[model samples]
Target: MEKQGVEVVVAHHERATLRAGNMFLKIDTDQARAEIEIDAMERAPIPTPEILWRRPPVLALAALSGTALGRLGEPSTASSAAWAAVGAAVRRLHDAPLPPRPGSGIDELATELDTECEWLAANGVLSTDVITRNRRIAEAALRPWTPVFTHGDLQVAHVFIDGDEITGVLDWSEAAQGDALYDLATLTLGHPEHLGDVLTGYGTAADLDVIRAWWSLRSLRGARWLVEHGFEPNSPGCEIDILRTQALRA
Candidate 1:
C-alpha cells in the first residue's frame, strides 16, 4: 500500500484544515466553534461531510466527492444549472427549522462595519470614494430581516458540485439563524454573473438592492481580516474589485 501524504488545506490563526488520505481534519483553537459546527451539521437538512470522529480541538470528516463550485478571485466553470442547484439547496436550508443559536444582530453588524470602514480609510486600504460608496450600499443590509437557518459562510468554494448536481456543502462553523439574503450574497460575492441563475432556482424574487448591499457590506467587514490572515482581498474578482465595481456603478 502507498502512503498518503498530508496536504494543508488552509491555515490561519483561528483554525487549520488538513487533508490526509480520505479524511479531512479541522483543528480549531476554539472548541465552542467546533461544537457548533458539529451540531449544525447534524441538524442541517442538506448534504454535509460525514463526521468520522472528534477529539477536542481536532475533528475529522470523510471527504465529499466532486469539486468546489468556484473560488475567490477566479471565474466559475460550473454550469448555470449547477449554480441554480446550489441556490435551491440554500433555499431548502433556509426554509428548514431555525438553529438554536442566533446570528449577529443588526446593531452588532453595524458596529463592526463602522469600525472596519474606519480602519480601511485610516490605513489607506481603499480610496475614499470606494469606501464611501460601498458604505452607503452596505446600509441597505442593516435593515430588519427575518432570521432563518443560514449557512453563514456560504462562499462559492464551500458548495461542491459534480456536473449540474450538488454533492455536498462544507464549513458549517458559521452556520446559524441569520438573514437568508446574506447567505445568497456571500455565495455570489465574486461571481455576480451567476446571480440570475441562482435566483431562478431560489423560487422567490429577492431585493436586488439588498443583495448588492450585502456584497458591499461583506467586503467592507471582511477586508481587514483577510489581509491580517495573510489572504489577498484585492485579487481580481475578489473583495477589492467588488468594492471598486460598486463604486463605478454608482
Candidate 2:
C-alpha cells in the first residue's frame, strides 16, 4: 500500500490498485499516466482518485499486456438501459469543450505504433511489416472522421451499473482525444448486439467503413500483443483466435 495525503491505495491485483478515497488508480507506467493526465485535462473531466503511486516497469508490463475476452451474453433489458445511459454520458463527455491543442501533434501516434511493433519484433512475435501495414489501414480509415474526446479503453467491465442506470465509467488510463466513431466502433464490434441500443442512445450512427476498420485494427493489435507476450500456447490463445475471427470478418 502507498499513501498520498489521507488516501490509502492498495494494489490488490496486477493491473489496478484501489485508492481508499473517492477515486480509483490504474497501475501503469509513469509515461502512460502522464499521457492520460494530459488527455484528461484537455478532453474529459479529470476523473478522481488519480495517480498516487507508480510501479516499476517490470510490474507494469505484467499488468497490462493482454486483453480479457469472455463470451458475454446479451445484457438484460436493465443492462441495456444502463448501456444507453452510459452512452448518453459519453456523449456529454465528448461534447464538453476542450482546451487548445498541444504543440505535440498526433505524430506521437506513429512513435507509439512503432514502439508496439518493435516490442512485438523483440519478442519474436511476427513480422513488423504487418503491424506497419495495419496501422496504415487504420490511419486511412480515421482520416475523414472528426476528432473528439475518446475513452480509448471502453469495455463492458469498465462500465458500472446500478439497477437500470449506468452509475459510472472507469479506466481512463488509456483515454485520449480521437475519432469519436473509433470509440463507438470499438464498443460495437466488441459487443455487437448492443450496437443498436448504444447508437440510438448516443444519437449518432457511426460510419460503417470507419467502424469496421477500427475494429479490424483493434483485433490485429490484440492478436499481435498476445503473440508477442508468449501467450500463444496459453489460455489466452483463445483471445487471439477470437480477435482473428473478428478481423477476418472485417
Candidate 3:
C-alpha cells in the first residue's frame, strides 16, 4: 500500500504491524512502548526498525483481540533456544557503556511502574496488592544493580532466529536502560515452565536461579498488563497463573 509517498508493508508478525518507508512507523497505543523504542534508538541499542508513525488505539485493539483467542499457551524448543541466544546477545549489548538517563533519574522507573499500575487498575484487571508487590520487588532488585540498556519486552517473538543462531532481536518499543536482568526476566516469565533449554544455554545453575527470580518479578507486571488489556481472568489464554506459580517458587 502506498500512502503519501510511503510504501506500507503492514508486516504483521506477533506484535505491532510495521509501516515502512524512509523510516519506520509503529502503531501501538502503549505510550510506554513508544518511549522504550525511541529511547533505545537514541541510546544506540541493537538493530531495530525506526518508528515514524503511530496508531495506538488500533494497535491496542488488535493485540487485545488476538489475546482472546486462547492461543497463548504452548512452547517451542526451537524458539526457546533462539530466545536464549537473544538473551546472550542482549547481555553483550548491555556490556557497552551507556549515557545517563535522558530526562529523568533511574529511580523514575518507580514512576513508570506507578503509571502502569494505574492504567491496569483503571481497566479493572489488576489488584492493588499485585501492583504493590511488583513495585517492591522491582525496587529491591534494582537497588544494587547498575542500569544498562534493556529490552523492556524481551521474548520469543521479539527474537528472530535461523536454526540455532539468532538473526536479530526485533521489537525495541519496550527497550530501556535499567537492570539488564529485567529483560531476561521478561522472557523467562513469558515461558516459565518452558525455559529449560533457554536457561541451560544462557547460564549456570546459580545464574539460572537469579534469572528466574528476576523474570518472576517482571512477569508479574506483564500478567497485570495482559489482564488489563482484555485477556480473560483465570482463563487458559492468560499466563498470569503461570507467572504467579513461578513467583511462588522464586
Best by TM-score: 1
Cα RMSD of all models vs. native, in order, equals 0.8, 7.6, 7.6
The lDDT of model 3 is 0.52
Clashes of each: 0, 0, 3
Better of 1 and 2 by lDDT: 1
**Residue 220 displacement in candidate 2 (angstroms):** 1.6
Task: List TM-score per model, in order.
Answer: 0.98, 0.61, 0.59
Candidate 2 runs further than 4 Å off: 1-25, 28-35, 38-78, 99-140, 226-239, 247-250
Candidate 3 segments whose C-alpha is farther than 4 A from its true place: 1-25, 28-47, 50-72, 79-81, 99-142, 193-210, 232-238, 247-250
**All models: lDDT?**
0.94, 0.52, 0.52
Error of 3 at 240 (Å): 1.7
Under the 3 Å rule for N, CA and C atoms, how many clashes does model 1 have?
0
Top model number, lDDT: 1
lDDT of 1 by residue, 44-106 (tens): 888999999999889999998999999989989999999999999999999999999899999
Q: For model 2, what is the alpha-carbon lDDT of residue 72?
A: 31
Q: Across residues 1-250, which tens digit of lDDT does each residue of candidate 2 receive?
A: 8655533333333344444344444454455554564456345652322234444531211122112221233333445665676677678767766433322234554455556656656775544554455555556453544557777767555555656565545556566557677677666655666767777778776666666666645655565554544445223323334344443453
